[model samples]
Target: MKDLNKQFSLILLYALLFQGLYAVEIEFNADKTLLDSKKEILELEGNVSLKYQALIFEADKIFFDKKNDMFSGNELKFSSLDNFFYGAANIVEFSKTKLTLKEVEFSTCPCEEKIWWIESDEVSFNNEEKIVSSINSKIVVQGNTLAYLRKANFPISSERKSGILLPEIAINERSGLDIKVPVYINLRENLDLTIEPRIMTQRGYGLTNELRYLGKNHNGFFNSSFLQDDKESFQVLETDNLRWSFNFLHQQRLNKSTFFETNTSSTSDPFYLTDLGGFMSGLSRTLYLPQQASLSYFKKDFSMRLDLNSFKLTNPLAVNQFQRLPGLKLNYFFNKNNFKLVLNSDIAYFNKGGSFRNNEKESLSRVLFNPKASYLYNQKNYFLESSISLLYQFKNHQGNKNTELSPLFELNNSLKFFKLSKTTKIILEPYINVAFSDQKKIINKLKIDSGLRFNPFKHKQQFGSLFLSNQKDIMIGTKLTHTDKANNHFKFEIAKLSTLGQKILFIEEKRIDLPEPFSLKLKYKTNNGIIFKSHLSLDSKNNFNLTSNSISLNFNKYKILIGHYFARNIEIYNLNNNSLEQKKINSFEFSASVHLAKNWSGGFKFINDLEQKKNVNSVLSIDYENKGMVVGLAYMKSLELDWVSILENDTFKDYHKDRFRLFFELKGLGSIGKPKESYLKRRNL
Candidate 1:
């Protein structure tokens, strides 16, 4: 085959010998050039350099069949727009589109040292196809060999191609030693997949698959991970030895006005996430796994949805909670003149069986409708709005059916005064909101979505001072704000709320009397990365005692945060046995971080139980990072601090086993550590 190709090239060269060069142009300077008319050959020796079309070549000696436009060289350095290659023997043929190099050293790094490179026994590339291929190649970083491959294909253009991504390594308590190898495959123009195999020394192995697709009308991704745990160390959890999780997100445009979506997450067991060692897995620690699918339509000011949702409960006793087998919701709103009209309707059916709340099957179907109308009077400085709403609810549960109707009225007003200066401005705003509902009593046990009981009224604060209540209520508030040309801002607000002849309830199942105390809040932010914020809630009945408060301060690279919660302790009674003890919640949280240098930083965070006089969770870490690498050392410790143990007057468990990690990372490569920093960042700590 080689002789045949050489003969064909010779024939072509002889055929083109009489033809003069047309579009071909070459320019270079060399110590000597030799041309043989009969042989149809040209040779350039001694520091030969030439450029033809997109090819740039430099060699100690070059031989060219000028008629056929073929070049061969020794100790050649070859380069093009997308690639660079150096080898002792190099070949360029067919108008410089096809190249082959023997014992070549290649790299994407165009720098002098080639900090990262690949050495291949034989490397080839085709500019027309924009593909580079190599056989028996080894990857080296800073002269250190890191990986070897029998064959590899990499795209020379800005195209998606199949290749191996950087591998991942980590060490943590749950997994001990872990590594993940990933391969990315570009299956089509609009489809791709990443397959990763995870090996964990402590447990077993896992595989993660991520498939993505894009189409004219639909696009989405499907990701899943499966693991087999041979250790079976958590048999006491009553869970299977195999763990797995799946997440699917899909969106499809059915038409111009309709869309379909499915955002779902499901795991084999509720504790699977807690046992996993990823940021996503750790942050998803929940008792119930959620899966939902919905199809929706929109037209101008109207929208409708049909949804299906379900949950997997970790505990059998949680069967009392109902799942939305299917639900339909509709919303329509439009403005006519200065009046706004809105209508909302929802209907859902829920079912549960097998030893539920009362050891019997339980089912519930609900229909709710709400219509509201609001009239607004707007001005530059002041605005007033009045809204009226009608709510009707129908429910059928356990062979019992009930219907209720409620009417609500609300009034809101706001006024703003602004004083302007050359470089500063101050604004003072006062707001008032009053609401009333025509209902003799409220339903204290109105369970809504996800089986969460809700008070008849919902409380919300606006502008930091104005309180809005969905139930019968009244509120008054004011806000003051100042801003300067330096981009500094300060805001202060105070608000008060009063119930309409009924007690307001809290999520903790406690009721409060009418006329709640004034709530005050303050916030200040400066251009120099300084911020101060505080919020306080007072108990007016208890001589205006502090019910709850939180303060946060941030100056440059340092920050401190503290929070206090107040509650009435029923366990402790005064001498009269009727008076309860007003107590602050026995907990405090503190966190601070500072940047010690341009590439060095450290931080510490801790949560302590003041009553128990112990730390619940604490973490300390120091990190160093530059363009090339990142290193960190972190220590973490946590105490159980179980509420059940506290109730029973028992000491909680405390231990810090294998809670420290030393991390290292190479830029553009991967990291080895616990990967808990992402979890902590997600928690905003």
Candidate 2:
């Protein structure tokens, strides 16, 4: 009997090896095996294991019918080679192209804890299609059944497929109970579309559609929304019943050195954003929306660009701004050794949609040219640079043409001193700049496309003092800096300006004779992930009155910012009267954010009108995150202007409004509400 069994084992091994050479190979091992050649059947018992292609099966017992080329097992456990899927089943049957199982439990999670899984009565997989289908399945999470489905299909690979995305639910004061269901369609590998339908308990139904496309050298998206008979439109603002909004953005690489880009957006009414805006509604508090397009070409030494820019006014209190119908710009650069030269030229037509002089629309055409040249001298401890610039502008309004030219000269010098040791190094730098411009006064009434930047910390005092102005002036500034290898930094800067030809400086519609206005700035950074910055501006002629002051601090887990702005006498535009009026402004701002714990965070922000003793805006938020889930809550209060009362009283009146939001999200699945990160990022914290 022993001799016969040994001969049969050799025969079985040779037969399996021959079959593997030309067709699907099946390999199995067991403690015991039996074969009946007369019936063409094979049986295995005690720890049976089989492997073919990328699939592996383990069972207590297994049987194979050689004539039919099939395999079956009981109390089986199976998995894929990549470990992307694994499961256990009561009964399992598999062939070269398909697999079927009964009373199966499976999951894609790799962790041993098994946070979630799926239970199904039957499950089958098609090798050729790379798809898995299940009947009568239940989704279980944390040992609790969450959902049930009669039939479902899931792809085993990461491929784009059309399906219904998760819906968003929210409750707020403006819209009450709001819900949005979005449907996605994967039209092609490079294109897709999403259509979302929204319902509000207090408002009417709305639809929003978005289309996106991508190519080898181009990409773009279009989004539009429409709502009929918005109840808020008639109840709050008393505007049209129909509301809509649309946005379009596109970018394309025309060639290796050329590019084209365009972005434009519009709304049917001003209140559209306030009522229908998503989580970012708090940041879109502006009264104007911009629309722009540009085509640019670049080379090693030269560049050219064409641009069109416009804006749409969203509020009656805002004044119309000049638009560039079409603008052309050209620039040339030359650099050799320590010498550099640059030439810039621009031409544009500006038009505003409002009647000015003689009941005619305000319009102007401008041509500007600027050229500059510089030379640098460098040494081991000192550096110096000298530059000269010429600016010329030509303007034509109602056929009345005029031109002006100005020349400027400047000198910049800096000295550096350093000390080095085994483990530490320190350096100090002191720099000074002296500039003088020709005594020329250009009398141009319209500021076509230039305006003052309100923030003082963004630019040097001399550069931020005035913009697009042709006046005789002399500016002198100095800055000192200290740095060390220990990641410590400190800086201080001061600047002074002297008007040569004009006795009183005219900024916008304001006239001032403050000759000794200067700014002081300081910044410090430490090695322990902390930074401090402050800026102060004062006018000597006005008893050193503080024009603006700001301070900010940042650490590992917290941030704080505070600011105060005071303008003694400034001229502001009056849209109702079409003129300028002198006014005073005094305001204060505060913002803070902190990480309360490992998985908890909170933030607060507020702005105050000191002159009026009122709060302009305030916001508070709290969030928690853990185990691939997020929950957040927030509240906001804003002061809104009453336009109807303004017209009757000739003054503005403020009314307050409150809003609340709740957010929740489950990672890898979908979200139930808008994420707080959207608005948090807008605050720049």
Determine the backbone clash count of candidate 2. 0
The digit string of per-residue lDDT tens for model 1 on 1-685 reads 0111111223343346546554345566566666677666767777777765455678878887766666777667766645433323466555435666566776654355455667888777776666678899997877899789899876655567777776666556766777877888999999999898889888888888889999999999888888887656665764578777877889999999999998776777655654563332322444455567889999889999999876555333444456677899999998988999999998998765211133445678988898999999989999999999877888888778877777778899999999999999999999999887664433233344653321211223321001113366678999999999998999999998776565443322334343466688888888876666666656556444334345566676666566554333322323223343553345666766767899887777676787779887777888886655567887777664323223222222222333665676654334555433541332210
Q: Which pairs clash inside model 2?
A: none
Cα lDDT tens digits, model 2, 481-570, are 666677688777776655555535344554544344676777877777566666666665554434555566677788777767665544
Q: Which stretches of candidate 1 lie over 4 Å from their true place?
A: 1-98, 109-114, 126-131, 135-137, 145-159, 277-283, 314-317, 353-360, 442-444, 451-470, 505-517, 540-615, 618-680, 683-685
Weakest 10 consecutive residues of candidate 1 by summed lDDT: 459-468
Q: Model 2: residues >4 Å from true position, as ranges?
A: 1-102, 105-112, 122-134, 150-160, 233-239, 278-287, 353-360, 450-469, 472-485, 494-517, 542-624, 639-657, 681-685
Error of 2 at 104 (Å): 3.9
- Give the C-alpha miss distance for residue 597 in model 1, angstroms: 5.3
RMSD of each: 7.7, 6.6
What TM-score does candidate 2 get on C-alpha atoms? 0.78
